[model samples]
Target: MRTWARTGSGLVLGACTAAVHLLLALPVAAALLVPALRPVAESVVCRLAGLERRRIVVLLGGTGGRAEPPPARALRYLATRIPVGLLGGAVLTLLGIGLTFAATLLFSWVTQTPWVMEREAAVVVSGLLVAYYAVPGAVLLYLALAGAGGVARWERTLLGRLLAPSREEQLTRRVEELSRTRDAIVAAVDDERRRIERDLHDGVQQRLVALGMLLGRARRHPDRAAELVAQAHDEAQRTLVELRDVSWRVYPAALDTGGLAAALESVAERAPLPVRIHCDLPVEPPATVRAAAWFVISEAVTNAAKHSGALRVDVEVAMVDGRLRATVRDDGRGGADPAAGGLAGLARRVAAADGAFTVDSPAGGPTVVTAELPCA
Candidate 1:
């Protein structure tokens, strides 16, 4: 029922746009012929075509392709679509007439009003007469609805043929996407390197330097050597902990030994807030895909714990179709920016793995980060 309603609305809208097309057809043709007016015509036609493309996208749930058609193709499409729109309008008009006729016949019969069907004198309406007329009315109404559907389909196909990108254009677009992905990977790698450097310089390296200084002082001053040695032991332990953290950030050894689930469990164990993890995978994903999924989940959880001020987080990982989908949700302040360093790095990582990444964080509430990686 809802689908039929949408079809009906689309047909009405198409009919209206067709009327506009009819008015502009002659002037558009004239403008195309005149060198100075050609650009103007193309501009107007492109805008109209864009409107149509958006209609198809919103009403029919289509991508409508990546690129717009050239001016010549746009003109051709305009010419061809006019008739389809008119046809839809005609069907709708017939449907309205059929409905009106049925209503009039029923009204006359119910009230026992005298009505003339032809040139004959007025006669009282009867149930048999109403039934006799009802059959054709119902058939006409059915045909009208079917025609509307057919016209909608025809319009969709027409737009696809004339407006959608060609095979060569699609290949070009794919190449451009790959180029961008390569650049993002390079930048992500560089960013990771700098992050590691900062951690070593500010944490483990500083701790080690202090340990060396303490040992040197202890060797010179034997009176306080015991105290200095104990302090040094504590510093060494802290340094080991920081070093372990840095290593895990680079790549979790658990991923290689126990797979993604085990690695995620380790993350959950170490997180500051409560984290519930649900993992369901019938078969292990490819190593690269697993790594991408892990990073997405790991980074999202880290962000939530450190920045979102969340009390609890939920992580779900499963195999959907031929892809692995991982989602992390935090019930804290929203407004997580994808352009931020951590989230951007996650995007780059997913793109490198030929996956899709999305973040839905509205103000004053939960933040949800999801990534889908192809298992192939």
Candidate 2:
């Protein structure tokens, strides 16, 4: 590179320098190698000239010469290797220089020009041309190569010292952590199911069982039997609805092969008030995304049915701009607060999936729950 700088023109040298710098910026120096390659290459050329070496020392010192020096041993090693080293160096350097010209030839052809013209121009150019231009450019690239090699050496040593893992290994650890988190989530869901089951057996289920007995006994009351039967029927119906909801919360069957639409339809059908469903989304959404949509809609529908007191509910779902958008609004009651447990859980779940959840429940009867999810 130093020799090239001393001999070449500015434009060519400048390009060489830029390329060297760019390569050095990378993690590995790769082709940025020591001058040793020059001689080894030249040895092949020497064979044609019928030259022979007893043995060749590629270089004088250690690979990068970072080892501790032992003067006596070093002297002995150098003395023995110097003659062979010289022959190797001359052979390789000549080869390197020759290959460099070969490369120039190929480049000129690829560029639709002639190498002879460029070489003539290079030969005519003065030190000022070479020094101020080409040589400087070559030097820049050489320095970059040296610097990159030094950096790679440093990185290996540093990583060894610090015991840092490779990129893939670190990511593997992260995946394991996320897997643990998912496992915990599954466990917590199961626990919640047990609690809901207990609540049903202890609270709503027992009430309905008592109601059934009351109605049976009511048949014997001659005077107020008609009114008693009516009350019992109403109570039983309410308990049955509550029981159905608990199971729905545990799992939504419609979320399977039939997809989100089916699950959503079931929600609307189950709600007490009339609901208009507007679903023009893709028939299938990703499982997690689809599940998120299902939960969010189910929550919104339940909220509308119980609190909004609205006469009609509108549920709209569609994928817009690579996102799943769902809007649920009720005309019954207007005000809803996010701090409430129901909406809060929905918000957290959507956020976990890197989606957006919002509620626009204004006072006085039009409450809209809007959730936007990135399904893609």
TM-score of each: 0.81, 0.41
> Which residue segments of model 2 deviate by more than 4 Å?
1-195, 202-245
Write down the worst ten-residue block by lDDT for model 1.
Answer: 59-68
Best by lDDT: 1
Per-residue lDDT of model 1, residues 259-317, tens digit only: 99999999899899999999999988888887888878988998999999899999999
Worst 10 contiguous positions by lDDT, candidate 2: 52-61
For model 2, residues 121-235, the per-residue Cα lDDT tens digits are 5433333433454555566557544543343333233223222344565799778867755664565466556658787988688878879887877878858788888888888
Error of 2 at 285 (Å): 0.5
Candidate lDDT (C-alpha), each: 0.86, 0.60
TM-score of candidate 2 to 2 decimals: 0.41
Model 2, position 185, has a per-residue lDDT of 54
